[model samples]
Target: MDPRLTLVVISSCIALCLGCTKELSVGELFYGSVIETKSSPSAKHCQILCTYELRCAIFTFSNFKCELKRDDSGAIRAVSSSIISGRSLFSCAAEKKEACFRDEYSQVAFKDKPYQTVRTTNEKECRSKCDNDPLCSFYTFYKSSAQCELKFWNLLPTAEVLYSSTGNLVSGYSSKLKLNINAKYNCLSIQSKGYLLENDYFDYTYSGAAFTVEHCQTLCNLNPFCRVYAYRTNGHCRLKLIKDSHTQGAKLDYVISGLRQTDCKPNFVGKKTTATT
Candidate 1:
């Protein structure tokens, strides 16, 4: 081989090897040190573009936009449902793909009607059916009835679509759909198997279905006006606003409630009281 050609081949191999080491981290959004921005159709494409950009060290892709970053060392990593972030290896390489799914919520179901219903022997089979269907984005499995409900929508549904249900129900979403499940909030405390702080002064603003008590708390946290939340095992969530510093409570089976730590006013306090129904 010619000396010049031999040197060129060795350089090409090094570049290829460098690119093959890049790995992806899904559901993470990295902030700062953006060197450039480009429109990409997918996370994989954004990663490929980063590999070709000499200055790109890391990239975050979301909603068809890609941001190339120079330094990820001090960058803040936030959990996001839509954003996908990865570090680049400074050379072009094939994108790696993998099966990804979000954690499942027990005793939960989607309020929206499923696109298709199939009778399955177990939750695994139900999940398999959803995995095989191109249109399925989320699903609910009823253990008692041995039925799977495959759900679909033009876009991913919000947390409001989920509701607490029978103990036999379970629900989950595909990570590819990128549903927003990570909301920042802290609970002062969670009361289980009963509702608290229900009184005339603290009337509920509205009610909806929540997949879990945490889901209900997320909804309350996102609502600027929400001060307290109550969740029932039957898949019901109630958001409330309380003006009084003192509140009363009652016993209700299969119900849980709590106050958001951020919303706990200095004067506001919960007073649990027994009720005979």
Candidate 2:
């Protein structure tokens, strides 16, 4: 989430519970290095925009100009303003939201092949894409190339940090801790019909009636007892109610086995059933 957008969302939620104003005061600012600048409508919007940015430690807005700065070394505060200055509450709120921790290294990238690749407009969007993918542990984004590489491994291949002279590449890792904003169901990754598993027995069989793999996965997600499932092309969806049932390297060509990656395991005894034509 964008920090300014995040603040806006939080403020809205807080307003619903308790009526509050848009005023947010962090503290008096000093000299800082300007990271980026954007046109802002109001002082509050500028504050929110600054708070929304990860690197923006402090910001000031005047005459529709918002200057976001990085104040890690405390040098950006030579001049302070009370009319349009605010501090960032992102770190504090990030803990509550379980936001992904980021570490950016300029001109650095992983040498090994990435498990996945996606295109994004900015580094922030690229990082967010990696955060959403369960398999992605780290990622690299090149501004000039416009390529986002999502890697499965946490560590870089070479001990030496990759460097770029032009300073177009930025790389980082995802914290993996994510907030389950979706209250209904925690769905797993969906694979094609070619993917199948062995040793996993389905406890119950349901007539899918021309249901797709997506539909069967949804059904499994909704049912508490379902842990794994197998969906056939003929609309036979089998829901497994046991953990560790999926044996590695067990492949059934006709059945598509879908595994649920949840912390909760089924305890009740399940009866085996066959699909009826």
User: TM-scores across all candidates?
Assistant: 0.30, 0.31
Best by TM-score: 2
Q: On a 0 to 1 TM-score scale, where does candidate 1 land against the true structure?
A: 0.30
Write one digit per residue (lDDT tens) for candidate 2, span 113-191: 8877889998898889987886665688999978999875321111123546778988776655332211223333645
lDDT of 2 at 243: 54
> Against the true structure, whose lDDT is highest?
1
CA lDDT of each prediction against the hidden true structure: 0.58, 0.53
Residue 24 displacement (Å), model 1: 17
Lowest lDDT block of 10, candidate 1: 265-274
